[model samples]
Target chain A: MSYKQVIYTTAPDPAIDPSLTTGTFRLNTVPKPTNVPADKLLVRTHYLSLDPAMRQWLTAKRSYIAPVEIGAVMRGQSIAQIITVGSDLSSTFQPGDWVVAYSGWQEYAVLGAKEVEKVVLPPGGRPTDAMSVLGMTGLTAYFGMTEVGYPKEGDTVVVSGAAGATGMVAGQIAKIKGAKRVVGLAGSREKCDFLVRELGFDAAINYKDADWRKQLKEATPEYIDVFFDNTGGEILDACLARAARDARFVICGAISQYNAAKPQGPASFMTVISQRVTMKGFIVFDYAKKYPTALQELASWLSQGKLKRKEHIVPGGIEGAPQALVDLYKGVNTGKMMVEVAPVSEALNAKL
Target chain B: MSYKQVIYTTAPDPAIDPSLTTGTFRLNTVPKPTNVPADKLLVRTHYLSLDPAMRQWLTAKRSYIAPVEIGAVMRGQSIAQIITVGSDLSSTFQPGDWVVAYSGWQEYAVLGAKEVEKVVLPPGGRPTDAMSVLGMTGLTAYFGMTEVGYPKEGDTVVVSGAAGATGMVAGQIAKIKGAKRVVGLAGSREKCDFLVRELGFDAAINYKDADWRKQLKEATPEYIDVFFDNTGGEILDACLARAARDARFVICGAISQYNAAKPQGPASFMTVISQRVTMKGFIVFDYAKKYPTALQELASWLSQGKLKRKEHIVPGGIEGAPQALVDLYKGVNTGKMMVEVAPVSEALNAKL
Candidate 1:
């Protein structure tokens, strides 16, 4: 069988601005991966998670993970359906099982058992949630907040990029954890409205406004206690300026600077010293051992109607993955940006 | 009785380069503070500690501590001898007892009993050591290393401002803690030599050299596991680039940016995210409870000749305190920089 795949062709030019063209990835028709080795399973991609980390994966620079090699399928995480299982791993993963895996930007992947996690969603939970709130995004918010941010009751928590996938969930979690105030910094007025009106953020500041700094100060009257920083640039500097004494600034993601030809540091970083703040940069993979507990709690919150889930699903299967990533960088998505290659069964959609 | 004191007259112009004139402090002669209130002890300053923080105190801007008001004595830490004890506190302190106190840039000060800690130097220890290796500098190094930096055995620990008060002690502590390669960044070849020869740093790079960054990379070939950053600016950016995975950056000071009109933030701060680093800025006051333990351990090290002590003592009484601070900012001092206002008794000086 033939399937579609996105192949990385060349490294991006850092001198030029990052865009769809910066990714040098091309869609190609390829034979579906077959000959599953012993202890491996053959899976078909259903939904591909379009994340900001994809930008880093395309760069030649060393990061937490290696750069995707040229002529290889673009690296990505996907919700997949097991098509065939090798005899060695037949008991662990049988045909028809739905799982989340590091399946890359390809329709079909032959993955070892360890590469995929069998995602068991609750009743009425969508498999797509596993790619968003129930998977890496939600878990990233959970551990980064509890472990690094260390929010306390009556603390004023400020989150940058608060309308994005991890940011929205992080603010909600801060609110749920008894934070006195949860202020969000988003780009658009609509996203700000969604955060405060729909997502329970105490207040939201439109960072694109000329007086966003003033808005941030007005919103966080008592100063910030825990700062969940997703966008790292001027917004981060503004947040740093208002940081309370001994504030914890969790460096979850720096989406704003990821594409910059020369990423400028926060100008108000002096507050990190004046306020004696702890700024920690972390990767969610560092907390892999605690993912189960985080997932269970997130699932509980979702079932109880305490947590909301949203996804901006792009069409065109594997061909849309690259463009969806560009849209993510442009802040066009309100929630988890994903490319849906194959739809789930009507029964599964109805359950959700 | 007449006494000499330095008074801050105005805030400095950040746009102008900082000099002795930048600090609008004037030496004044006034009647000694003779009326020791109940619960207070009158102290005659012996060694006035001139710290980089004194520069911040001169500014009207908000910091960890309140700014020294115009016409008020310049704020400083000092080693002093009890001159006259108030009857109410006669049991706690007596004349001729040596202590460390927030005596400011003055010849005499009336301080409450709680404002000072009695200095009980080890046998054969100099009273000046109380203002350096066995005092706040040592304490800053101890907690910033053990609590924040958390240098492990065989870890490459890099320290900036290698020959300064806190940096020297911090690097030595890293060595004492069994760090594999302890590298230092200093301003001059002499300071670098002192750090390597006298202070036991594995390697010392003169940051004033044209190829300092390259030297840093070479000195820390395996990259830095822990970075004790004292000089934050371009040197900090260079160090951040060589940070190892999960490196801990203890932000003890930013001496390099203290005088800048607009301190530039470190450009390579994204390395914090890529390397999963924890950069923490701390004030020594936060670890007040642990001072006794730190002091005892540091004293033990000094007594056993494990830790070396160096002091750049500026003479000419309390009048020199202002100029000594300017010298501190200029990186003229090799170790602790202090102004010796009054001569210590012949008996105390003999102990050196």
Candidate 2:
């Protein structure tokens, strides 16, 4: 059996908003290889992970990691099945076994046995759910807060892009970690409502509001003690103004400024001096070594029914992929923004 | 016998460009130590230390430390002679012993014994030299480089305000630490020449040039690995733009921005994310405990004549103090700005 691979085909991205992710994957049908090379395994992709970082990876610039070349399939974390295996890469399963691999943006791929970890799915869900709240997005929020944010009890915690996968989980984590107030800044009223009503955020401020700065201060009267900033730019500047003494500003993502012609600088940096603030930027993949612990904690919270997972699943094989990528930058998707290839059950679709 | 104490008095500081300075400090002194109690120590001030941080202290707002209140005798670091040590608070020093203390513009002061620390003269130099080359300024150069800059052997270290007291020393230290290139950024062609010819800086760029930004890039081809910034504002913004990966930007002082009604924020701070830079503001006083080690090392450097001590001393008694500070803010001072209340030697005659 053979499958298709989405590839970066052109460099005609608009200079103003230069992420022209057009979905038209290169499809190929060839006989499956029977003789695998040493340390090679066949992976039947169960779910493909889609993230905004994929856009950055499309360009061959000096990003946290190298971008995907024009001819290669885009890079991502994937869950797959073992269709066949060679003797050297053979494990427990003879021909059929469920496994998680990082063979990205493809229906099926060949991966080295050591290249991917077998994610034993939780009792409540499938692998697609594991790719989100129970996976990297959840872990990114987990370590960013506990390690970088380090919010103490009664500390005011602020999160940017609040209704997104990471922000939603981060704000809730801060609350669970005994934050006195957890304020979130989002782009729209719907996200604001989701943050406050669903995620238990103490307050949510739409950054689109001109009075957002005032609302932010009001939401955080004591000033923010720890700011888990996923989206940087004016919101980061506003947070800088209201940062309490010794506030921790974690730079998880700068989604707001990433696509601009000239990136936004921190305007009120003098506040960092007056407030003795510490701002640190990190790549989520750098902390991949600690994901198991992060996943364990997130899974426990999910299993206890204390945590919620919401994903905006976009369907179609690889045709909707490019639009999904463009829509992500526009903040069109409501939640985790996953592209589904195969379905689990129709009853599981009821939540959507 | 009662000797009339001399008090420096300025009618008021005349305004220059408000953008360059918030305002000038008028050194007004009342009757000095006329009511010195029997248990108090009457100390005669000899030398006053002038620094950029002093300008910030004179402003009526919070900085890293509390601002000096208006109408109080302008605060300064002065090396003074204990004229009369009263019986009540006497132990560490006797009358006539030289000591270092925060004695302002007045020629004589009634100080508590606890307010003075006896100046232990080193083997080779006069005590007032202690305030610049071997005192707080030297320590500022030390910690700002070692703790913050952390320049590796092959890394290029750039120091702004490069001909100033701290900057000159910081560049030498970076060279001593085996830096590949040490570049200096100064305000004049003469200062740039002096930095390159006299100080051993690899290249010197005059920030006064119309095309200084281009000159800076030329001087530092690979980009600055460690930026020891004293002059902030546009210079800081430029440095941020030219920073290398994992650059350390140690903001010792922002003399250029200090007087501005609104501090200019960095235009290219997003470079911090791209370059993985870390910018931090630090005051030398916080590292006061390391003064001994810093002093010992600097004293050795001075004795060997490896370190140069250039004092732009004003000739007068306490009356010259206010104008000396004004000249510093005007960038008129050649090197370490200081006010001589009395002569250092026979060649430096007593103006009084």
Candidate 3:
């Protein structure tokens, strides 16, 4: 019997094109392991997450975490099912249990019990929610907005990459936190409309438009009090120019510059001194201790329909993940991008 | 009698050359005023303070304060002596009393009592202390370092424009507040040595050197915990590359970019995210209500010799003021730059 896993090969050529023969990643077939260690379990991957931060992981440079080494299984997070339990773990043994783990891009993985976190679904929540709104993405939006951005009542809040997973939730959170007006920036008219009509954003601007800068200026009449930036290029520069006195800039990610060989900084960065702004950057993992309490609130909001979810799930198994990731850089997904490697029917049957 | 005042004539031609026949400013002869209003006092200018921030005031753009209008007396701060007291302010102000005011560049002026702050010298403190370490420049360093930078014990601090008025004090304050090592960046070897030897900086790098970046790296083995930036250009970019995690960047002045037709930002600014850095900008006047307590503490430090003062006084009177202003942009002064418009004989005589 055999299992398949994606292996990292070459580094990015400024921008990633996974279809090339000498691309950054390639799929490899390997013999399935027949043995599970006494303290380990064998699991089958059901869904694998694809995110913008994964691009940062491909570069051969130092960051919050180490870059994925060549010839290694590509790094990832996924929902998986227990296929077998170890003999020494009989007390806590579980087959057919659903859990989340950093299992990488593979069909099956052998892991110790401590390596996976058992998923306990909230009322009216789905298993996929654990990989998104009730998981790291949701937690990032919660902490970045409330803790770093500090959007106040009546403050004009602006968010870039507003249609993406973390940004969508961050924009909605600003609204729930009592911001007077919330504006979102996206790459297309449909995404803009979806943000305004579906996500309840007060206004949404298509940054790809020729008059986008002017549109941004008109949208932020009182100026941006809180700017949650995920795309760090021209949009960040424009926002910096329109920053109000004592504005707070929460730099969550820089998706726009991730592919560039040499990323450019905002030209209006000097406005920081003139306007007395505070620009801070953070990684979501820093708030690990507060995850549980945050998930409860996120789950509550999802149940109440105050928060919404959009999943762009591809279904051709692990093979589709690399192309999906490449499409992500092109703004191809409306929301969270994921690849379904195996049938989630077991969890769905249990839910019923 | 006619008194001289430097008049702002034209906007900067990218850079100011006060010697230009058609320049940013010109010396104008004005007839001396013969009358003093009941609510105003006549004062003779002694020493006028020149600062980098004055350049920002020359541009016809909206900022924290209105720009100096064309054909107006170039704005300045000065230590002056009251020549005659207003009828209404006789008890509050009298002849021979030394005071500080935004009295502009001129020999004499009439001002309401409210326009000037009374100067009360601390024990063993010189009257010039009011123009440097005990004045606005000192307050800028205090509030910016303590409230913004928040340098912790066992931390490394780096300061640019390290020999200037605010940066010198800011670097010393970091030391007094218990920073383990302090580094200073200046344009000349002499300024660097003065900083390391006389100002107690642990290391001083002359930024004009070809290997200054290598010197900076060798100086900060622990990386920069706090960066008090006074010159914002390539120096800022260099500091950003060596920033420690959670470093605090106090954005004070950007003298390097003050005259650029198009100021460039730090190319390595993305490190703010990778390192979870916090960069904040502030103005000293924002803490006006707390000035009294700040001044008392600063005076105590000066009396104890924990804080030092240095002044570069130009002595050809008001005529020397224009070229002095031009030389400021060239980093001519090692410390606080000022012009001695009139003798301090009256204040000195009163002390006897």
Candidate 4:
């Protein structure tokens, strides 16, 4: 049997220079492994999650984790299915069970027990919700608000890239958690309106607005309490200047400055002191253990019509992974971006 | 008897373009206050403490507190004495009982109990320690370090403006708290030695050095657990980048950036998220109630030879107020800078 995977031609270099994003993704074919053991199964990929955090893997440097080596498979979370089992084992991962796995952007990935956490889809929702509203991105918003952002009722909470996967959920979650005025800042007017109308945000500001900072100041006269920052750089610095006393700044990503050769610093940092604010960062991987609780709660909200789940699906195959991610970075994808691999097969199932 | 009180006038609208350091200081005469109550005492100013924070009062805009109104007396702490008693309650007042007052840049003033807090000097030594070690500046360092910085034994700590009043005592407190390495960032070469050698800091880095950032990285390779920052621009930014996970950055005073019409903004904040650091601003006025405990601890340390005190005294009446404060702004004075308004009656008595 043959498995198609998104293989790496060159790892991200240390400089974070232009070469890192020099279309570093590629597709390759690899031979299937031997027969799976009784406790293992093969998973045929249905979806591959693309995120900005993956950029960190491309660089070889002293970071929170080891960098992805050159010519290795790119790591990611995906929704996949068990096609074939080598032997009858625990019922948790029986064939046809739709599950979430760290299966990378690959077609036929092999896995052992506990390698994937099965996604229990709601009555009417698709499996993609597991990767968006109920997966790592969902947990990122959940914990980022609870532990870092410290959301409070009637508080002015601003979120950057408000239409992106994480930002949308983060804004909605802030509103759900009783933020009185949830301000969404996105690149396009459509995304801004979508944030305000579709997600129950109190207001939406376009980052492209020439007077966005002045508008933000007028909108939040008392200053912002929590800033769920995804797109860092100038806007993040603007929010810092407008932060109220004891404000909480949650840094989930800095996409606006991430791809640059030299990341731009904050434009006004004395506010961090003058305003008595707190800024902290966390990784969703750090909160992996809490996924079960997050998934259950999110699924409950989704089924009860309290939350909206969105997914941007890309056709699965070895060739589409690179452009799929590129489209994601371009802000083309609305929700959790995924790629469908092959029809459920015995070869893929045996490794699940 | 008639007396003329002196006041330093603001050079009518003193607005520094923020890109430059040049400023003007002026002196003017004030009419003596004609009202005096039974409980209110007439304070003949002695030594007027000139703190770097005075720069804020010269401006006409809003800051942490309202900037000193033009034509209004400046706001500050002054060591003074009772000149005349209005009531027959001789038991309540002597011709000269030394006290601390917030009478601003004036030679004669009337203050109620709320304006004055009595000083109980040490039995064996000069009472100057009250202004430098047990005063607001000393207490500022004390509570700012223990409460905000929270240094633990064996933890490395870096204090910016390390030879200034607050930083000087802040580093000493870190040492007393059992910090393994107390690193200091001071302005001059002599201050660097004064910090590490005389104050027993494990390391000292002169921020004036061209390779200061490199020296900071080398001196604190293990990362600093606590950063007691009095200077908050580039040095603070550099330390923020090199901060270890869970490091605490306490913003006691951003002296380096305070006088700027608009601070040049913090330049290296990405590390705040990457390192999960915490930074907070504080004012000594907020911790006024806890001064007794802080003063008690610091006074005991001074008595036990565990801490040293320093003061830069400028002699003259209220006419010297503007120049004294201007000298402080130029970093001309070391330790606590004060203008000797009049001889403390007790000091003269002791000399007699």
**Candidate number of the best DockQ:** 3
CA displacement after TM-score superposition, residue A8 of candidate 3 (Å): 1.2
**DockQ comparisons of all candidates to the true complex:** 0.68, 0.34, 0.74, 0.50
Q: Is candidate 1 or candidate 3 better by DockQ?
A: 3
In the range B183-277, model 1's lDDT, one tens digit per residue, is 99998999999998898889999998999888988998899999999889888889889999999999888888877888778878788888999
What fraction of the true interface contacts does model 4 reproduce?
0.50
* Interface RMSD list for the candidates: 1.2, 2.5, 1.2, 2.5
Task: Give the alpha carbon lDDT tens digit for every residue of A1-352 in model 4.
Answer: 7777776666433222222235476667788876777878887777788887767656625456677776788888888887666675655567778888878777778887677887777766676777788778888888888778978888999998778788888888888888888898887788777777788888888778898888888878778999999988888889988888788989888877655566676756666655677777777767778878877877787788877867677764546767776676667766677666653343333333
Listed for each candidate, the true contacts retained, as a fraction, are 0.66, 0.26, 0.70, 0.50
Cα error, residue A305 of model 3, in Å, equals 0.8
| TM-score of chain A considered alone, across all candidate predictions | 0.94, 0.89, 0.97, 0.90
User: In model 3 chain B, where is the ten-residue run with the lowest total lDDT?
Assistant: B343-352
Ordered list by DockQ, greatest first: 3, 1, 4, 2
Provide the fnat value for model 1, as a fraction from 0 to 1. Answer: 0.66
Q: Against the true structure, what is each candidate's TM-score?
A: 0.94, 0.82, 0.97, 0.89
Put down candidate 1 lDDT per residue, A1-352, tens digits, no spaces.
Answer: 8988888886766421223444577777878765887878988888999888777877837588888898998888999988889999877876878889889988888899888998799766888898899999999999988889979999999998888899999999998899999999988999999998898989999888999888888998899999999989888888888889999999988888887888888767667777899999999998999988899999999998888877888886677776677779889999888998887762223333
Q: Predictions ranked by TM-score, top down?
A: 3, 1, 4, 2
Determine which window of 10 residues in candidate 4 chain A has minimal summed lDDT. A12-21
Error of 4 at B193 (Å): 1.6
